[model samples]
Target: MKITVVGAGAIGGFLACKLFAAGHDISVIARGATLHVIREQGLRLHTGNDLVIAPLRATSEPKELGIQDVVIFAVKAPALPAAVDAAKALIGQQTLVIPALNGLPWWYFLKSNSALSGTRLKAVDPDGMIERSVPTDAIIGCVVFPSCRVESPGVVRHMSGSKIVFGEPGGGSSSRISEVADVFLRAGFDAHAHENIREEIWLKLLGNACFNPVSLLVSCATDEMIDDPNLNTLFVEMMSELLELGNRLGISPKIDPLQRIAITRKLGKVKTSMLQDVEGHKHVEIEAILGALISVADLAGAPMARTRTVYALARMRAKTLGLLPE
Candidate 1:
């Protein structure tokens, strides 16, 4: 399958390298240092003791890369508008545009049948910019369950887990989803097509909404935040709020908080992607991780006071540090 992965960050690099290694025609839409490094040094991925390189064709201009069978949008939430605009050239009529992103995807409730179906989240989309940019029929939402980071430009390091759940917005299995899952499974991923991908997304977001903001506010690593009494209390409160919101929407991943915490603690001192953005003076994904949930909580009539408070604190910190727009 010919595929293009937008954003050369950790998740993008990881999936691009692996898919290329599996003999798929891989292209990357990247800019700046990342484009240079991938062309010169190749896209390198470090998995445990092994370091693999991908001889991929990468260019900053999307027009250079023609229509593809699949286009994975793995960019952070803030870059979606511009990213989708650039990726417009890759979307053929039958092209599958999989959004393997963080938090709540902008396309979550676009054509969904949930209680919140067709609801556009302004916190993330901001006046439906992304909605108008990407076609709704082509989107297949993905839940990425991995912890990886870009160790440096053109290099991605996988820390733990490698499962990606794919599902259509209308729910249940489809031929396209099965085909996509087969492609990913061949690329050496624990990939599967879920009947209800939204639940999986919520499960992933539960930890992110809690851990990412707590990491940002306290300036602590994942394990450190889980260990601190006051921060841990905040963590629980934020997670509780997210779960309640998910439940009210009739979508909750079947996982206990203790199990989720155990999974996070296993990573041990890992800096969340948001925390890393804060440290590196880049824009953090406050909207996708926290703001979107708050917006939905209001629509769903779920009590998300704690989540809102956390979102406000984190957003303020990002603004004060000049990491986010005022």
Candidate 2:
């Protein structure tokens, strides 16, 4: 399969390297230092005790790569709009687009059979540019569970977790979903083709909606946040509000707030991706992680007073740090 991974950041670099190693033709859409590094020394991955290098095609222009069999979007939420715009030329009629992103995707409500079907999430796709550019039939919902970080411009360090779930946007089985899962499985990931990918997305968002923004507010790691009594209470309240909103949308996650928190606590002193972005002076995913949830809550008529409060504070913090527009 010919694959092109956008961003060439943490998740993008990791997947590109693994897929390339598995004998798939791989290319990357990147810019600035990342593009230069990959072109000069190839994309690198640090997993376990081995450092593997996969020399593949690397370019900033999507048209240069032409149409790909599969295009994986691994960019951060804030960069997604521009990334999608730039990568439009990479999607052919038979192309499969898998967005391995955190938080709510722009296509979440596109084919969703719930009352909110066709509702556009302004938090992620404020201008509907992504919706107009990418075809709905080409999208395969994906939830990535791996924790990875960019060790350098062209290098990605795999920390832990390898589970990647794929499913059709409208739910049910499909050959495309299974094909994508098989591709990941060949690369040594714990990949699955789920019947309901939205449920898996909501389950992951249960932790992201709470941990990511709060970590930005408090400057604490996962274990530290879970250990603090006051913050722990806040997490429970925010998560409960999200639970109600999900239920209203007909998404009933198997785990509760406490169980989810416990699972995160077991991950030890893990720094969330939002915190990493803040510390690195990069843009955090405030809109996608928190703002999107609040939008759904409003649509579902669920009160998210506590979550709204945290979101406002976190948004202000990001703006203050120059990570967001004023």
Each model's lDDT: 0.87, 0.91
Q: State how far residue 139 of model 2 sits from its true place (Å).
A: 0.3
- What is the TM-score (0 to 1) of candidate 2? 0.98
TM-score per model over all chains: 0.97, 0.98
lDDT tens per residue, model 1, 200-240 = 88899889989998788888889888888877777677777
Q: Number of the top candidate by TM-score?
A: 2
Q: CA lDDT of 189 in candidate 2?
A: 92
How would you encode candidate 2's per-residue C-alpha lDDT over 1-326 as one tens digit per residue? 99999979988998999999999999999999999999999999999998889899999899999999999999998889889999999999999999999999999999999869999999899889999999999999999988888877899999888999999999999988898899899999999999999999999998999999999988988899999999999999988988888888988888889999998887777889999898889999999998898888888888899999999999999998999832
Model 1 misplaced stretches (Cα beyond 4 Å): none
In lDDT terms, how accurate is model 2? Answer: 0.91
**So what's the TM-score on candidate 1?**
0.97
